[model samples]
Target chain A: MSDYSSEDSETEFVLYRNNPEWKDVTPVKQDDGEEPVVAIDYTEAFWQYRREILKGLNKDLNIELDFIHKVILRQSKNYQVWHHRRVLVEWLKDPSKEKYLTELVLAKDAKNYHAWQHRQWVIKTFNLFEGELEYIDSLLLDDVRNNSAWNQRYFVINNTTGFTEEVLNREIDYTLFNTKDVTENESAWNYLRGLLLHDKGGLSKNKKVTEFCENLYKSGNHSPFLLAVLVDMCCEQINEGGGDSVYNLDRARTLCNELITKYDTIRAKYWQYMLDGIEKRPKRARVKRLLRAQIKHMDS
Target chain B: MFTSETMPSLKFVPELHKKYLLFILNGKLPNLESMETNRTVLMYFALAGLDILDEIENIPPERKESIIKWIYSLQVVNEEENISGFLGSTNLITKENRGKNSPYKWAHIANTYSCLLSLLILGDDLSRVNRKAIITSLKTLQLPIGSFKGAKEGVEDDMRFVFCAACICYILDDWSGMDVELMVQFIMKCISYDGGVGQGPELESHSGSTFCAMASLALSDNLHRLTKAQFTGLRRWLLCRFDAGFSGRPNKPIDTCYSFWTGGALKILNAYQFIEDPNNDQFVLMTQDKYGGFSKWVNTVPDPMHTYFGLAGLSLMNISGLNKMFCELNTTRRVHDCLKKIQEKWK
Candidate 1:
């Protein structure tokens, strides 16, 4: 791993710099000398050799930036090339091109994992968070089911500023608006939970969130994600001494039945598990409520 | 996505696939001309695919011996560099430059893993594997954070190589190659709040990486380190991966590979019982090609990697006519039994 201490350091460096030069490649005559080689451009060989060159880099060394960029343009999925590019960019102290390069690569393949990971690195290294939300919006508009875009949105919102109530509420609204028509999008659902969990109090205690969920439920809308969230809120309420059986536990149980029977059959077992938890919650809640009444009576 | 009450009549062409593996072994694979770097992994897929079909006995003894010889020829024999593991193929090595003095003396952990498994599947005695030197090479590849690179050649240190290193260590019946605490720390950092593990810290939870993490933890015997809530959350995340077939992550389309990648993770976590659904079986069957092998999606081209893993998923679900697989080692039960005998000899 320590390349500097090795005896073959010079040869290894030469291997790292041994990328094929396209200008040196030319058509060659056939063995009979009758006609020029039809497809003797050696383009495929050049690219394969270029990949070997990139793969030869050691952690302690560097490579030419132009070679790294060309290799990345040819093979965007080759994360080793991307790592080399990142190392060169940081070594040169010029990270200005990373964002543009990542964008260009993503334009070709939107869900390229290496491109996404590089984008996050570039954003953090250069503090290039401006207009990130708009970028995420564009990605989401193209495909609302893109979890990478949602994860990036979560990163940008949380890292760019403090998670105050105003920011949290705005994020909730943003996610809610996107999920209003499509409740099956796990990206937006996860985003909503991620944002709400950062708040001081949970989602059940928030009036706007509770009303929003109640309105969605009462309007005869049947999104399994929405029902699941509503059930969670109901369970939380029931566990918090909100002992209104009609509104909290009973509604949650009915929704659990709906989830198990009609919606989300893929995860019916999980819903059953949730229902079992709901059943167990009452006994614990009863014990807590009795203890609270006894303490109040003693105080009186 | 089929909504019919009856399951599809899936065909499993064991004979055609066996012939295909033989062709691949004989170097008749024009489509894989440029995949020389991944030759060892491809070989593993082919051999293991046949093993899962219980067709290893169909190969002639001489052919199996030659395959084992080819795999051994790729092992790096450097003592000074201490990187004594198997290279991917002989493409990087020439006859003129084939010793400790050779400049191309390097080994990739992933390739080493494939070579070792293929040898075990071929019933090769563990006499030739330089366990001490391979452990030393593994130590050099491990980062301070416990992640490992595939090779010493500046490759990305991610969960993939970490899993490979863990498997190599497990195969050798040795834990001296890595720092268990640091490895556990790295894996812990990879576990997202959503319960799924990622490739590294702060990355999105992915099913493949989650499997690698789980398998690494299982191999290291440190799965009990997870808190109860974390364990439950992981189970929930894995169980929720099903929506007909398993997807790698939330909102992703179901693919056949995740049937094993995610399914294998669930099996390793001892939570396979919770993943109850007839739809998973139907969806996996839907990806089977009419000729042979399985593809990532229905109606797509079939490949070796997906074919092996698809059979592996069926084996995990106890589908009839398929041999059970050892999920942690990614081998058929027969190969795993051979490995246990080898371990007994070592003891």
Candidate 2:
């Protein structure tokens, strides 16, 4: 029997330095004294030898997982550590505990990209899509601005039920309700736009969504995201070339003007670019025309 | 001590920033242990940061030669495993197992990209690079899904590696290393509903991944693969990211690095001119450390990565006293031109 102790818990974990089996191994310290810029101490051989020893001893999978968990606690963003964890989970063939591990890491740092990626992989590979929506909802409830949660919600919906007509309606309603609470919440607005994209006729075809935006606009909500979506719907309407093409074009132009002059002034140049495109004028001509109009308006 | 009121001035301070990079290049800071795995990337940032500051000549020629040699020593050309690229550090290869075929010693795509650019920045000719071996090995890293793994043993394959692969092939003046059509398809699939690209399919649309995808497409001459609507959508998505500096995702805090990632993507899309430059410049400058370098956010300790990208973000705005950067390759114009000449010779 290898000297590896199976009784070790997470807190009482033994490192290579304390382990009697690894005492003979002369661990290479990083040559930071010589090379200041690129002194990487651990080599592939070091890790390979450790893995070989673990495999040779027929060590419990929990020990390896605990060791990785300890390392991840310190270096949550390390790609290699997360990759090793994934490999071990696959070997263990039970992903039941993986989500909990990722959750613990994420609870510490919500935007830790590696943790999120690993969670997504475990959830997808093991078909553990159940309750993922509730998990996402809890994350968003904690912080509605967590874009990662919003993205995971999209991922779960797409992979499981998909964006069926019924699913789309439900998502639209959910996203609309959230948008009403925080009209400036870009994530919720982006989510709504994502749902509308799944519709056959694009943003303009979603009468329900258009009505939502119109109601919000009429109610004195001038959030840049809200106006941006309305402008997109109007442009779609103009492109589809129905009886309301003229009205839609006029509304789109007015919204673009408002976006530039009043709301969304930070992105004024983009709004101007949109206006130029709507008028189908050359860029230089559009710029010159805008300059002339601004001068005329200022003089008047 | 470095509040806005006490901020020195709204100046680029190339000298102070260059001093910080030199400290990174010549001096050993104890805090760099966390960056041991990414030593090559750290070196690239220092060297490239100096080049951007127009102070590459500060490094004596002998030191430059030694650095060049060090970079070349990390190259692995194993024909059996079809692995040809640069490792991040020599710590992975001990004397006993040196030159042996081990999965752990596989060359990494990101390391290779950084090493190649570092070589050109140091004025090394392309004679030492094993073009054939590297390109041959690069072909094996591509997956059927058109994305690329970082190495032969790498489990994580994403847009970052795809970008690195594109940079490697483009720098070597070869396209046989990857399947451009499939790669383009993969990038297209990564376009999230928000119109920004992500690390992979169904992932969150992030500024860094969007930059990687768009820059890869541009480098591979596959920009035309995007439909007109997709192009417009991408432009809108990029333009919408600007709030003070920029954010990787919606509702995220404005970070200094996104100034380059999102700004670099906009530069490629011809939409960078639309950004409110003064606000971005002020935001980046506010994050400048009083000692030297820029941090990810104001009041944070500055690191080499954020410092290099802060300079890069300014370089995109054509900041005074800074060298013009070729945003696609993330190197200076002079080095890019040198690379172009090397490619011309290859043809």
Candidate 3:
């Protein structure tokens, strides 16, 4: 951010002053040029570089061996850098090779959204299949609350190809025991619920999530943000395609009341009305009407 | 890869305006606690970006009308008061005490350029903007040596404002903001041994300021306006920027915003057509969160300003599912439509 202000100090040599002068870049390393070469024009060298870039990107191999990383690092904002990288990645489509490369990329920038996105791209496009709970466990060991890792965990268990009830059950056990705080517990709940929603292998899993949520409600720091997530998740279960009308409704209404008494925020209030809106009960209807009136005359 | 379906939430919003204005109400105009202090300034893009996307919902229509009306009120009407239609950076009208909080009572070329762009983006009729005042302001800002100052006041003159003045005059169908001959000479001077133009002649070429210099010429109806050597050099400099997102200069990390800043420059140079499309979309869209909003660099916080530019970069490719927003002006393709309208109405 401070670099934005560094504009004033460098008054001399204008733009890119004191930066490295570009050399006459050849398309290749010149496989056998042993003799001393003459100085070449930068513009011509630039053309050669672009020609090479296009060539590298246009390779027919299933997986390109082009060094797109080196190219993207040069001019960071151009469309060509992104275009070339994608082309090169598409060129490198061997599933076994791509899976190995994904691990290398994750190691290089553990939080690189682009690299991670590219790995997902490789998997989705190439049909690479693997179990990830063991890998996810290692990430949690480093930082249980790592948001991207949590997101990746969710992506894998829910979106990926290989998963079983046993593996996911293993996940619930690890997440329940290893997580240090309540946020992690809530996060684990969210991830596990995603699996249950997808029904990977159709083993009843939300029972584990249901048990965890029950425990968390009894004793855990409930931030409104998290509480909001809790209400939504509950609403999902209640609103399931063919849920138990009696059980889910009673639980939703009772929990909504519990949430309203515990959290006095607007979102909580709205969710309370929504849960109550499940049925046109006299008290709930009256409150909903009053809230709407207040909202209508909001400024007042 | 291009669809908005991957997003956890997909909804059109013109919500940031109220949030930003409320910050001013709270005496947090800079809103250091919030990331987008530049909103009041960049609303030109935000409002316009939304307009281009055709997603100006969440803002009540009547209130949106009033905000556009107020933004129009800030335009420098003419040269009589030594004012112009170039928009002032932040015009805070608090508690009936109007103009008390305006940082400086002058038109900033950059803000003015952006303000008109926002107006155009929000589908404002351009009749309210007084072209002469903005042109006068531009004329007043340009120094004798070919550089332009930010405002009419004794201010630091540089290439950024030169771009702003050029944009205002271009949109307004006027060129009073610049002495084109001297402007060209200054740009020529800024050209280093490499083709890229810097803040000034003898300055190093930077992707950011270089956009200003190049786009200034392009909008001025002077794409072939530079010396032959300068033109070729500009081409060379732009070609060097084929990195992941387009860095401002060498050894800088690629960020999403530059995709438009430099990508637009190449488009203006007629060089953008040379680059392929899918890579650009995948790159810029990578900045977008699966949940919401776009970030600057990868794995960074998402905010309004970069979101605007990130979308603009995609729009440059005419990517589906987004309004086509010009990277520099940040208005819809309707600016060219407006230009055609002006030509039709006047011709």
Candidate 4:
């Protein structure tokens, strides 16, 4: 039998630790006394250092990926681990498989922030905008309440089509359709509001959106989101000096009162604040208000 | 199961929370293994929680000195490479290579932020901090877009790092660390379609990132960067998140942490008055664990992060027995006053 020295046996079990350069390196201990608040496990410290050494050595990408996969599986929300994965994917220059990994992580926890972030990075970095809308659609179809999917839909459109006039019209219709399905869904309402604001003219300029809100309001839909959108529309008109300023201010105040009394009582103070702003019109708008008051006085 | 009617009488147990934080600081707690890399952050939650609870005196003077020394030990300064920041722990440093710089030993922006705050909470003068080296490192970490990376060559550059960098610059009273104009531009780009800010451009609007962005701007005194319409939209987005307590995103379940993330944002925006206080306070109190800590949700295990944020959320509402927190700096008014005095001295 070949003679095996103890040193060789030690080297076989311990990889980076037994290296000549690392021989003098002893992991620094935290000065926390016994039973420290944040205990530093020296074993973990050693392994962390060892991994850094291996990373410096230009280890195989597959090995690093596998290690990262295991760590992410254990701790999906760890930002550091996700950052490490991004660095590895950048090094590999092949983010083709990253989406699938993010999908796996998201499957375990649908709202995993780190996973969604990684997915966004992969899609953006590789310019993989194709079929992403369909992916978002599938996610929304499964759970229309998934705000992440709604946000992703907005992201994909902004990145791919640049949200041009045509795209804005299409998105407005799309969001309206979803809002019709779930009148109480804040995500859909927020999406519609976002689309309207992104248009060249602000919310008041979007006749289609105003008509949609008017239709919903006339249909006896008192959803707080719907009412809030109407108030926003009125405010936009008043702010832009479009249509009848006095009428829009009155309408906005009424809508705010409705929100405070019945629709969104939880945020009554916000509605009251809106009412105060409407009542305290800016100097330019106040001048318009005084003229209207004089006209009303003359008519009376 | 806790509804308005069924909720227990609201209680602010400062002593219980103080005991819990002290125990965690002096003793070990299980299930925190995942935070091994974020030791400094963990310490911040504990120390800062105690500060908010007005029980910093519980920690003996000798112990405070050791803790300060421990925090200082994690500082990594290499003036030649213009790198200076604090490590989360001494894990990467070794006995023989403790003071010498290595490629693997670099400062993490988040850790550095936590370290400065921790030192302040412990009443350290911050004179031992390497301001020049840290400021230089901060300059290098800034991306062209005005956002910052957590460290050099760090991949996770977003509003979170921007907030950390802002806090560092504000604490050190140094504006040369980052380009404020570029940082403002980056924050503007992060405004999502829904008016809430996201971690980065074109990303989903999240309450946490909204707080980070808003606080960064507030600290830099650049809140004027937001347009009037944008400010209105932001306030609308934040107010709409109230569902008993605030949620990070639309159509999401309410978590205890958003009380700080969302509430703190509103506080900075001067919109805190819009929140329904009783409902929010009840929801937060319902998540308070009887054993002495707060969790993200009801019936979940309590952790240091949520515990600190929970106390912070209460402090924002001026809950009795808790010190008033400076929402922007994530510290008590007393500690922030101390910090302000230090900055005055620097001037």
Tell me the DockQ of each model, to 2 decimals: 0.18, 0.30, 0.01, 0.33
Score chain A of each prediction against the true chain A by TM-score and list the results: 0.74, 0.80, 0.54, 0.80
In Å, residue A288's CA in model 3 sits off its true spot by 87
Better of 1 and 2 by lDDT: 2
User: How big is the positional error of residue B169 in model 3, measured in Å on the Cα after superposition?
Assistant: 1.2
Candidate 2 regions exceeding 4 Å error are A1-23, A26-53, A242-247, A281-300, B1-9, B95-103
Instruction: Judging by DockQ, tell me the better candidate of 2 and 4.
Output: 4
DockQ of 4: 0.33
Candidate 2 C-alpha lDDT tens digits along B1-347: 13336445576688889899988887766656556656789899999999999898878898888888788778888887788889877766665566566657778888999999999999998788999999999999999999999887735799999999999988998899989999999999999988899898988889999999999999998888889889988998888888767888887788888889999999999999987544468888888998899999989999999999999988887788888878888888989998988888777
Cα error of candidate 4 at position A298, Å? 27
TM-score of candidate 2's chain B against its reference?
0.95
Q: Is candidate 2 or candidate 3 better by DockQ?
A: 2
Worst 10 residues of 2 chain B by lDDT: B1-10
What candidate 1 gets wrong by more than 4 Å, as runs, is A1-71, A234-252, A281-300, B5-8, B99-101
Better of 3 and 4 by DockQ: 4
Candidate 3 regions with alpha-carbon error over 4 angstroms: A1-300, B1-39, B56-60, B76-81, B86-103, B325-330, B342-347
lDDT of 4 by residue, B114-217 (tens): 99999999999999999988998899999998899887655478899999999999999998999999999999999988889999988888999999999999
Model 1 per-residue lDDT tens digits across residues A173-237: 88888888887786687678677778676757666676777788888877887887788777767
